[model samples]
Target: MTDHAREQATILETHGLTKDFKGFTAIKDINLSVQTGSIHALIGPNGAGKTTFFNLLTKFLKPTSGQIIYDGRDITHARPAGIAQRGLIRSFQISAVFPHLSARENVRIALQRKLKVSYHFWRPLRILDQLNEQAQATLEQVGLGKFGDVKAVELPYGQKRALEIATTIALEPRLMLLDEPTQGMSAEDVSTVTDLIKRVIEGRTIVMVEHNLNVVATLADQITVLNRGEILAEGNYDEVSNNPEVMEAYMGTTDAA
Candidate 1:
């Protein structure tokens, strides 16, 4: 695709994305392009640079060499906070929730952060009420409408994950990057988070690094398989899963997750 068309349909892209630490290359020459509104999965064996690449994409780490483009603009050198302002947001495996705060309060805080407001809730009562309403709506969107009053620390494990997602939605991101959003949970929690992820993905682009192939198979519009920091295959689930090279890579590593 031409640059114009590519940029038009693509929401996030990386060209020659390479990162090296102490002469040890983590990712080498990775070229990935995620469509404007699609769920893209990044999967590979352990130590395949998935985390490193994720850190680079989210600006948690600067690339040794490469260009990261988001929404037709170069963001390779942008800081994490700057990238977030441009609508590319990322969440780590651990939920970033204030355990002492209620679910509603957590969402409210995230909204305030999104709006760049000072954390002094004493600013204005009227604006606080408005933020409350918006936070409730965001919570409702993630199936946490009934848990608004519950303390985040008191919530069930799955519910805490849901709360995290709700806070993320409050940011109104155009593109979201989730790192193992469903990492540790019961089967029921997995199902719950899976359904929630499906619901939240409407009209937005999502790129996730996940271990649950089941979730990836169910939700990902595109999948990229990485091995030893290099992309081994990329396509829909079936296409990449059927690749002999991908199977071989997985076979060598017991972590098929």
Candidate 2:
């Protein structure tokens, strides 16, 4: 097999994954697989269980029934930190960074998390200088170099998300789960974040929950549509977009967004 083909082998797999709350099933029997080095998107109308499924993958919610395997290891039972330690990092959420610190400081903490340096709280100040250097490099990679010294809270809306992504990159994740990476952004910021997302997908796998069809069309190597707690369609953008059922699924929904 070619190198790229080998890289496309299954890196994350879910079998019969199910979740329920008070007998109301949120996501049911989801059997999905994400190939290595691919940008895979999970999309659907609101309340189609997209977030619930995303939560299941992150272990934010335990599966009521099923298995989750990552890089040949069963991770269904792994805690969030444990899974993250194994290189399955998640992002595009509001809680990923501290607004009180500067961009460099926020990324420095992520570096500290990866190095497990937090345990040694007494580490010398000199060590943090090294971290700040590395953290600045990460910020540069995500197009936040100019804002490294600015407090995260003071950053513009889109830059905050970019800073959040830079922190996720610090983990060196093998598979990154992005929940609406461009949820609320101006058109120009959308273009900026889009380019950033493309830059970071190199040599890694990404699974994202996104609502922007234009973004999905541009980024997804494969798209999986979920509806009413099940897989509605799966294929390339053109293939799925032309699928009658998939088209019908979006009708009367906010898909025109």
Candidate 3:
């Protein structure tokens, strides 16, 4: 494909997407497209409907009106498991991992989904041994190789988040929806995970809801800013960051004339 064709290839799209809770509207008439292999950031102040939008796309919450098209198919009514099966996966702000399981075991569990035995824990342990090598490789990819034998709860906060990324990678997702991937972390840990995110962006598209402007500025190919459940601005970081409305939305005021 030519450069133009590649840039035009959209991996996910939402048309007039909205969600309502009783009489309240969480997200209203949102239309967005994410290009293939691009990092798209959804940013806004608190309660900007970022998480609601993610839920709608992941089928965790059904949209009140509009369609969710992924890779050219409408999946608005698809189940969460079905959505995940199609290679659209999400990671939460909180580190998600098996607290008691070893790091290798956690990744192996995710890898088992590909083998079509995600719930076959009753099967022979030897059957899962086949995934051990791949699990180790994934751990290494996320910089957790040396901690494979360590239990997830025993790992440091940063390593725990790394393990979560490792498991997410083991599933081989085509599109990843990362919700606050750097939510609560030290400056050093944030930088480390940011680099990890950059390293993993090859060959896949990422839609992230990030509050860290630095991370968004560094990684996002495009940005959509939201306020009060509607889009306030859409463009590259330089464009959105400089918009007077975006500045007011974020800082409560723009520069004086």
Q: lDDT of each structure?
A: 0.90, 0.89, 0.92
| Off by more than 4 A, model 1 | 1-3, 119-126, 253-257
How many clashing pairs per prediction, in order? Answer: 0, 0, 0
Count of clashing pairs, candidate 2 = 0
List, residue by residue over 134-253, the lDDT tens digit for candidate 2: 998999999999998899999988999999999999989999999999888898888898999999999889999999999999999999999989998999999888877777788854
Model 2, residue 231: C-alpha shift (Å):
0.2
Best by TM-score: 3
Q: Per-residue lDDT of 36-76 in model 1, one digit per residue for the tens?
A: 88999999988989999999999889999989999988999
RMSD of 3: 2.0
TM-score of model number 1 = 0.94
Weakest lDDT window of 10 consecutive positions for candidate 2: 248-257
Task: Report the number of the highest-lDDT candidate.
Answer: 3
Q: List TM-score per model, in order.
A: 0.94, 0.93, 0.96
* Residue 199 lDDT, candidate 3, scale 0-100: 91
Which pairs in model 2 have colliding backbones? none
Q: Between 2 and 3, whose TM-score is larger? A: 3
Colliding residue pairs in candidate 1:
none
